[model samples]
Target chain A: MKVLVIGAAGMVGRKLVAALLAAGQINDKAISSLTLADVVEPSGLGIDIAHTVIATDLSEEGAAASLIAERPDMIFHLAAIVSGEAEADFEKGYRINLDGTRALLESIRLASQSEPYCPRLVFTSSIAVFGEPLPAVIGDEFQQTPLTSYGTQKAICELLLSDYSRRGFVDGVGIRLPTIAVRPGKPNKAASGFFSGIIREPLAGLEAVLPVADTVRHWFASPRAAVGFLLHGAAMDTAQLGSQRNLSMPGLAVTVGEQIAALERVAGPKAVALIRREPDAVIADMVAGWPKAFEAKRARSMGFVGDASFDEIIEIHIADELSGKVAL
Target chain B: MKVLVIGAAGMVGRKLVAALLAAGQINDKAISSLTLADVVEPSGLGIDIAHTVIATDLSEEGAAASLIAERPDMIFHLAAIVSGEAEADFEKGYRINLDGTRALLESIRLASQSEPYCPRLVFTSSIAVFGEPLPAVIGDEFQQTPLTSYGTQKAICELLLSDYSRRGFVDGVGIRLPTIAVRPGKPNKAASGFFSGIIREPLAGLEAVLPVADTVRHWFASPRAAVGFLLHGAAMDTAQLGSQRNLSMPGLAVTVGEQIAALERVAGPKAVALIRREPDAVIADMVAGWPKAFEAKRARSMGFVGDASFDEIIEIHIADELSGKVAL
Candidate 1:
């Protein structure tokens, strides 16, 4: 099977590409060719299989058509303008996120007109699709009432995916992923950046800021598990999804306290001591409206797995990024 | 306040126009001008204050911009490619229903750029947004996993409305109308057309086909009540809506047997006898996936009302369509 991974330059995207190259197959079918695309050129890392990297803007006219011209059998769409950026710039957000996704779907549908083609499309959605006055644990049946522009874009894209799939233009599996923890890299300015920074910085024997109270709970999955979800979504029998093409992927629910406890268990108290407490009111107010957990019944039933616990999540980060050892 | 009705030729739109002209004001604000637009020119209808009608398609280039140029203070966007047509023609469905709505929104946002003009935008959505695996009664929080292309378009529009409102671009209120019962017109090819056909044809002293079983249940609101919902949606304080701009309007849930019983009570057995039962397996299968009832608590709390009962719904049709008497 040939595959195209859009948004292949980002952290998760790069990780997914590496994993795909390592496995060299999806659903037991060998990966014969790979096409990676993003706004900036993605590195194939000189992998052996037939590899190609292209830098393209999906919102640009004819960009999606060119990408869909060859029509790789499996497509992973992970590209998105992040939440803060989308919220800050409305038109840009709608252009890149909403229009970009629509362009891709339209191109695919148009491509299948002459030849009968239905590629397996795996779209990454976000928990931001659910907003304020949420339940303690949001069920799979909960409506998507997105409060932010970014969430709205993702929700709309999910709808398009379902409709396109229903029309038999594409075989789409949209997984609403949880917040990825222990995101390997420098601490970013995103409000949710603290979730990973607290764990990552401390593990690296560097001081990190804790902006909210320890009771600030959220749903989380390791980057490795996120990649696992994409693979499962790509390979799964979509007939099981029926009319509902989207699912909230399973994730471990934990609070700041739980994450700290896990860190203490894995590393010593000294490693945990690198944390600094500081309350940020703006972030707290925003996080108040965020989803803390999900039932994710459908995805779990479909064989998609999540991290066992925060300990496992931290361990995955340690093994993957830290060379199996915490700097502390 | 200047008003613009986008789908002014439709049944509800015409009634709303008549109601507006009769009252000569909305929410105690004197109407200054009226602009009625549709794919076909809507009659400015003779007895009116400053009126204009335009035959235009929203999907066309610069059409939405031209409409927004005048910047009417209140806008009623009731246009859509109906369900069956949309399902049959996929590209046309997206082009008109989805892209048209987006164009209107984009124009509104751009109109705001020169001078901040936030119009009262009352968008009409539908119950088709919900699908199968439904609970006995869907609540305000039920997920919208539409089984059809039309439903998907409405769901996406609803999300857009919410996001636009959240950004303060437009004061938008999207009401998901129940199936309008006893729709004052010829029965069309819509699978759900029978819902109105049974009530309408019987009252008109004509034979009507009942394609589904008497046990089949569905949600409905009278044309008068639907117009009432629209007017309320246009005038009500949107500040009360918060971030969730869309609502499932209150409707009477009745089984086909209940509709027959109500028909009998309203216009006697002779009128009820006009309904000929011919169970259609295709229609039965379609109706089975529709939403039966809703806990429209949000709309109800916001003072939007529904028909008192199925009898009231029938009476509404009789009084409004038959001049207070059944044709039978």
Candidate 2:
């Protein structure tokens, strides 16, 4: 299938692109082409197929129509303003996250009215669609009372995806991913970044700060699992989804202490020792209300699997980034 | 306590306005005025307060700002495109329900930020916010997975209300009202109208078509009960709401067969004989998937209540609408 990846420059997008290319499942002859778009051109997003890169800001009026002009069979919509940015910049957040998605969905609906085959849209949502005062383990049936602007935007998009899919405008699947841990990149502006930075930086033999207490528990899946979710969503039968189109993806729940222990086992005491605990009162208050775990029975039944342990996640990072070589 | 009611010409709004005037619960000296606005002037509303009437189309850009210029202490937002109209006309629905509500909220937010006192916003949401294939009985905790465009708009407004409330811009409460049964008026465009028309029309010795089977079930409250829900939402302490600001109001759930039986018992067998069982397959299919009952424990604990039974609901219609005159 010819595929288009929106937000192709982001961490999960990069992994999905690499996975798709490495597998050769979508061939140059059979799949034919790929189109990648983002606010920034997806530099270092190297793929040898007939690829077009569009650095279009989608919130502007008419950007959506232009993007959907050459409709691909599958569209991976991974674009969103991160949680902290969304909470801070109200108008920009809603403009990009809510309006942009609606514009794209509208364009897709318009195009598919004439075209025989509408594209399959795999939307990456987040666990943040849930809010405070959650059941100890959040189930698929939990009502979306998103506590943050970022979560609200994602939940709204999920609603739109279901409605559009029910209307037969397009086949869509929404995967509400847990926070991707050990995110392989430089520290970003996301409030959740500390969850990843603590591990990723230490693995790279750099000092990392833990902003919350060691006992602070949270849910996580590796970036590799997030990519797997996208592919799995693309391959699933739409008929099974019916009207309820979103699924809360499966992941492991562990505390900061557990994450440190896992890192020590995998990368030696020196790497773990590089981590310093200096709790920021602001971040501690924020993380205090975050969901600790999920009872993702729906996702499990639908065949979406995730990392069994944090060690496996670290190993995946090492094998991919360090070429299966590690220095302790 | 100055009050403004949008869609003041609509059924629930008219009732609520009447209730507010009749009760006169606000300190007479403190409450100087009330403002009622709609696309058409709200004539014969029978309110004694020093009130202003505005016939303005809220979809216009400056309408909300002008409406809020008086700076009412409380705003009751009841304006929306009903389900059928919204489903048929997507753009109009989005403009009126989504954009209109956003404009009003934005105006209120601006007013609050510029000055000291933010108005308390009492928004009338709907059970349409919950979609099917739902659980047999939905609870207050049920996630909003709206099956219709109107519902999607309500859900979006709920999110905005929550975000605005969280930021201390405005105190907002969204009440998800059940289908108001025994609506004393000519049949309107709402698909759920038949639920009320079947009983109300038949009680008046008029033949009414039952569009769905007797086995079909739904949740409902009397129009009087709806007024109570709105008033309680307005008067109750919102600080008790915590982060889950919106609530599903408690109502009775009954099957159509049971409703007819209740009508027959209250108004004699002749009223039941006046019911025509001409099932419209389209409406039947639509009604079949709707939530028949709700576990509104949160609202119940918070003191919102409804008629105990369909029989009681029928009596309410007679006592309230028919002015204590029951006809067999």
Candidate 3:
């Protein structure tokens, strides 16, 4: 199966590529070729499959058309301006997140008009689609009223994905992933970066700042689980998704205190003590508006899985990112 | 206050224009000017206010920018391709319904960049935004999973409206109007056209076809009430609307049987007998998925009103459309 992964340079994108190469196949079909595209050329892949990497901006006119010219059997779209960046630069956010996604959908649609083509397009939506005034446990039927520009962009893309799928332009599946915890890399500037930092930094035997209160709770999944969601979404029967093409994937909902305890259990008190409690009201208010837990019955019923606990998430990070060995 | 109506030639748009002219002012401010636009030139309005009528396709490039150049203090955007038309022609549907609306919003946003220009943009959304597997009564926060392309377009526009408003690009308000009953003028080919035809034709001493069963229940509002909704939405304080600018307007929910009973009371047994049962499975299936009733507490709390009952709806039709007289 020929596959194309947009935004293939990002954290999840790189991991997903590795996972695909490791398996050597998807849905039991051998990977014949792969095409990777992003603003910056993706590197460090040691795959033997016929592959090509290109640096391109999908939002530019005709950019999406050029990408779809190859007509890959499956496309994984994970390109988006992160929340904080989108919120700061409104025009760039809408351009890259909203317009870019639309261009891609339109490209696929126009391509279908010329020939019999319906690619399995798996899009990565975000939990940011849900915002303040949320229910204690967000259900499958909760309304999407995103408070941030990034959230709004993702929400719009979800709507477009469903509409396009319903119209038979593309076979689309949107997975609203939880914040990836213990993200394996250097800490980024995202407000939710701390969710991973508190664990990843400690596991690496380094200091990490805890921005919010211990009572603060959030839904999480390891990067490994996120990649799993993409694979499952690519292979699943979209007929089961009905008219709503988007699904909020299952996640391990845990409090900061619970996360700390898990870290302590795994790496001893030294690792837990590395987390220093330092309050930042701006980040605190932003975190407070985020979803804590979700009743993702629809996604679960459809067989999409996640880490059962924070401990499992940490373990996955250690096994995958640290080669099953922590600094301690 | 200067006002601009994008769909001044349509049923509710004409009524809204009439209502505005009758009031001579909005929010106690004098109606200094009125700019009206539509696909076809609107005619036969004897208004003394400085007004201009133009036939324009909003989806065309530069059209929206031209309209916003005047920068009317209040803008009522009600332009759209109807449901059946949108379903039949996908490109035209997205072009006019989705792209057209976005064009208008973008024009306003760009204009604002040059100078401070946040106009009151009151948009006309529809109940079609909600589809099947619905609760007995849809609430203010029900998920929008539109089954039809028209509904999808409207739902997408609602998301864009909220996002633009939240970003301070435009002061926007979106009202999801229920099926406008007892519509004046010739019946169009819309499946839901029967809802108005069943009552309108009999009142005019003509036979009407009932395509769906009497047990089928749906939401309703008179053309007069729809006009009222626009006026109220325009003049009301939007400070309380928060980030979610779209509202499901209050409506009378009654079964087709109840509507028939009310018609019989308003006219006579002879008028009721004018209705002929003609089941069309296509329309019946479509109607089956429509919302029956809504718990529009948010709109009600904000002082938006609707007909109390089917009897009141019939009364409104007679008063507004039939010159306060029904053919007995």
**Winner by lDDT:** 1
| Stretches of candidate 1 exceeding 4 Å from the true structure | none
Poorly placed runs, candidate 2 (over 4 Å) = A24-29, A113-117, B27-30
lDDT of 2 by residue, B1-328 (tens): 7889998999999999898888775534345688999989999987777999999878898999999998888889998888899999888998998889889978887776767767889898999988887988997777888888888888888888888788777889999999999899787767788899888888777888888888888999999899999989888888989877788999998999999999988998888898888879888888877888999999999989888888989998888788866555
TM-score of 2: 0.96
RMSD of 2: 2.0
Of candidates 3 and 2, the better by TM-score: 3
lDDT per residue as tens, model 1, B1-328: 9999999998888999998899899989998998899999997466547788989899999999999989999999998899999999987888888899999999999999999889999999999899998998999999999999999999999999999999988999999999999888898999999998998998888999999999999999999999999999988998888999999999999999999999999889998889998989999998998999999999999999999999998888888888997777
**How well does candidate 1 score on lDDT at residue A79?**
93
For candidate 3, the TM-score is 0.98
Candidate order by DockQ, highest to lowest? 1, 3, 2
Which lDDT tens digits does candidate 1 get at residues A97-202? Answer: 9999999999999999889999999999999999987999999999999999999999999999998998899999998999999899999999999999999998
Choose 1 or 2, whichever is better by TM-score: 1
* Tens digits of lDDT, candidate 3, B1-328: 8899999999888888899999989999998999999999988867777899989999999999999998899999999999999999988999999999999999999999989999999999999998877998999878888998899899889888998999999999999999999888887898899998989898988899999999999999988889999999999999999999999999999999999999988888888999999999999998999999999999999999998888888888888778887675
True contacts kept of each: 0.92, 0.76, 0.68
lDDT of 3 by residue, A221-258 (tens): 88999999999998898899888999999998899999
Q: What DockQ does each candidate score versus the true complex, computed on alpha carbons?
A: 0.92, 0.76, 0.76
Q: Which ten residues in a row have the lowest lDDT in candidate 3 chain B?
A: B319-328
Pairs of residues at least 3 apart in sequence or in different chains that clash in candidate 2? A143-B143
Give candidate 1's fnat, 2 decimals. 0.92
Off by over 4 Å in 3: none
Docking class of 3: medium
